[model samples]
Target: MNQADIVIVGAGAAGLMAARELSKEGKKVLILEARGRIGGRIYPLPKEEWGYEAQGGAEFVHGEAPVSKALLKEAGATLTHPTEWWSVRDGPPSKIERLSPHDLQLEEALKKLTGDTTVAQFLDSNFPAGEHDDLRNFVQSWVEGYDAADIHKASALTLRDEMLDQGSWRQMCIREGYGLLLKYLQDACMQNGVEILLHKAVTAITVNQNGVSIQCSDGLIYQTKRVVVTVPLPVLQTLQFTPPLPKKTQAAAKIGFGGVIKIIIRFKTKWWTGPREQPFERLFFMLSKEPVPTWWTQHPEPHTTLTGWLPGPNAEHVKNHSDEEILTLALLSLSRIFNISIEQLREELATFKIVNWIKDPFARGAYSYSTPESKEAVQELHRPVDNKLYFAGEAICEEDANGTAEAALASGLRVAKEIRESF
Candidate 1:
């Protein structure tokens, strides 16, 4: 039997941020985390452990997010700019040597739309197929591949809003892995007096006039005054809320999320960059019409690793396949893209790994996306119940920053202020 002024449900970015903010204000905070490790969706893999390749459960800081920038600066993490390369599926694998007029067309299109609608709807309404197939492919691929979203259901308005807010944003990689920031946050929490219990799966949360009662799988009953739930929307749907949050539940159902299957392969040699024999030595990425549509190298790090990403509809097509089968398919896709034999790729392959978010119980999907019907879903999720139950996650972030690390951190900070004001 343990208690605190607040019991945070997850040790994710949002939870850690919330715990730090509240605890700094002299509130006793207890965080229950289902996983043994911290950092939730922001899973960071050590460069040494990952065959010297920089990887994260959710790294890829697409834009210069203020929260991430400040934290990374404080943590002494290095962010490197990645060189852009493009390729399209033609007879012998056509390479897009330079950026085209269609590069930032999505941003341009976003300015034209007046009302909230699905990306697919917006694209269809404005740029019909046949004449706009090139633009269609470019935008659809960017939205679905980058976001892991279903364009048909994903909110065009949210994408536009986020784009509008993005000023001179360039994609970069964190040299020291994303987990370092999490470690800094975790250390901050400890300094501020936050109690964290790892491997404590919260099964039920019952809130009454007295306070909030939390039941953990470890047979511990925690009684707290308030609870800030920072778990993924999918995982939150699994928890048993005593007085079921009808509005939150309804919002969760309406909000759209996408699935991703990221496979990282390591070769004995820097095959793609070295040896004039290889066709794509100068390029850092290869975008193809294969099963794994996106393949990128570990550049500026002197590693021979490539990450294959299967996003959006492509990931869904084979989401149920076994790990071994997925690995085989990745090889096949690469074999076709680089015009190499599968046997050769398998022979050169030193390691094959994947992070499957679709099957993860803690995170049923990769992240949230705005849908045609998700006009107020994020806002509904943000609304606290009785000022005792607070919700915060990337999904519930402001439209301009939703489904991002910045959003998660921002939500945590926002909710902590809300809790403080309520008290």
Candidate 2:
């Protein structure tokens, strides 16, 4: 049995941040993690495998993420912005225009939205079907692909706010991968006397008048005055609570969780940048209507790697497929998009990796998205139970940063402050 002033379950970004903050106040904190390694969804691949600090999950820093920015600055890390964006249809690829001809009309319709509703409902009401098919497709693709959201459940108000907010348009990539930032937080936690135990999957949590007790899969038990759970929403639903948190459980269900499939392929050289009329040398992003519909390059960094993304329903549809099968599909999509033969791509292929977050037991899914009830759901989850049980994660965040690492870090800091205020 282990004892601590507080026990933080799941040593992800949220857990590590909370531990660091609490430890700063001279409180003993123990973080129990299910995975052997840390960083949670912000997974970093081996440098030797990709020649650079390749990210397996959660790559870009979205918008004005204050917490993420501060941490990167503190860690002496820098950010780089992608230079261009392109889209491919039946023929050649062309640069993407940020605003479409329907922008003014869409903005006016969004402004007149009176009540909360699903994105599907809002789009159907405003854009309709026959006349605005292209506009509808664009909006739906953006919601499902980029946000990994179910249009039938994602909140219209949340999407409206995000689309209108110019800050949300700003994106930057970590020069050395997001792993550096996580390492900084981990080091800070350790330096402050916080203990992190890996592969300690918390099975159950019990809270009573005598404080809280945590039981791990290995049968190890922890006794602490307070407990903070920062596990992903799916994992949280599985945890056994002695006094069942029915309201919190229901609130979690009200919020939306989505999945993603990320495929990374490294080639011997930048074949797409070959001497051609339309060179892909400066390609940042490319969108298509293929099985793997989205692709991007590490622009300005000069890496011979291309990343394929399939999110939301598309990812879920093929979540159970084998790695080789998915790789084949990726190749097919690339072949069609570039009008190149699969034989040529295979010849230049150095290595490849597929990241299916939905299949990951620890993660279950990629990230959270807002539904019509998300606001109320987040509020309910944020309410500490008996001042002994606390919850913190990206799902608990209700702001524009809801699905980013910034949400996780900010929630951790908020929970830490809440715990301190209780004392």
Candidate 3:
């Protein structure tokens, strides 16, 4: 048996960060990642692969969290905010940019929320049926756009909590891709003597009073005093935990993992003329009706690539369709939104790509979201199971910060501290 002081399953932000923390105390740690690459959902594809810049997974840092801020500051990473938003609404599709008070409306609506209500309930009670439909759409769009959440299922408390907790409404993106953050963590792990084994998918974990034995699909075994399972929530649901904890199982069912489809389309030329008759001109984002309602450009950085986002129902809707069919849907959405002909779009389209996190066996879905029982479920995950099996991931984070890389990193540190104190 391959023995270690600790075994970390899934080398995403949480596992990698935990390895660094444990290594600081001279704990022998082994990190096994199912994917061939690191950085989990914060993928930054090389230009060689797509002939243009792209972030296949995580795109923005929503706020200035301490963990994220410290790492980013240390990396000498310059954080740049995207430009003003523009829309292509029904009236004439003019290029004139209009100042939108989207945040004000969203904030006012969020302030009225109370109790254990879902987003659907909040919207219905506040907006009614036909009146204030725009207000409803504004909040719903933010829910799907930021949370990648299912409106009917996710807690209203979650949305309210997130908005309340933010120190800044302005979102920041790394001038360099998000991969830089992962690289720093990866280097720290290596320097501290953590052993990282990529492409090692852990199939089963057997734990007893003495310790834990981990079985990998690669036909190897690892024995450790403690194990940190940081795999995605959906993937965790499918894992075989010997003498399973019923609470963990029920908790996993309570918290939700949402579906999302992201597409980065590289165009031959900058399509939006400029900031006027060209609403898309220098536009950071263009939000519209669903199937693919969200699109954003690599603005202020001279790039023609525009990312298309499909979350919640729209993402779930296209799960079984072929690549060609999915591509067509994206293309059609853009064609109608921009008022460009199909032939023109086809000609200008350089390359298109999709990240199938939903269908990926190891991921199973995008990130996690809050359910009514999310707080209790999350607290249960925080407790060490039999002093042998510990859990750390975005899913196990405090209800408010439950779906971010910062949360994952913080949780890793949290569990490592617990393990050390236990000894």
The candidate that wins on lDDT is 2
Ranking by lDDT: 2, 1, 3
lDDT of each: 0.81, 0.90, 0.80
Query: Clashes per prediction?
Result: 2, 0, 3
Q: Give the per-residue lDDT of model 1 (tens digit) for 204-302.
A: 999899988999988888998999998888888888999988888889889888888889888888766545444665566788878888898867677
Better of 2 and 3 by TM-score: 2
* Strongest candidate by TM-score: 2
- Model 1 scores worst on lDDT over the 10 consecutive residues at 94-103
Candidate 2 lDDT trough over 10 residues, lowest sum:
95-104
Q: Model 2 over residues 29-122: C-alpha lDDT tens digits?
A: 9999999999999999999889998888989999889998999999998898887888885357888756232478888888888899999999
Better of 1 and 3 by lDDT: 1
Name the lDDT value of residue 274 in candidate 3. Answer: 42
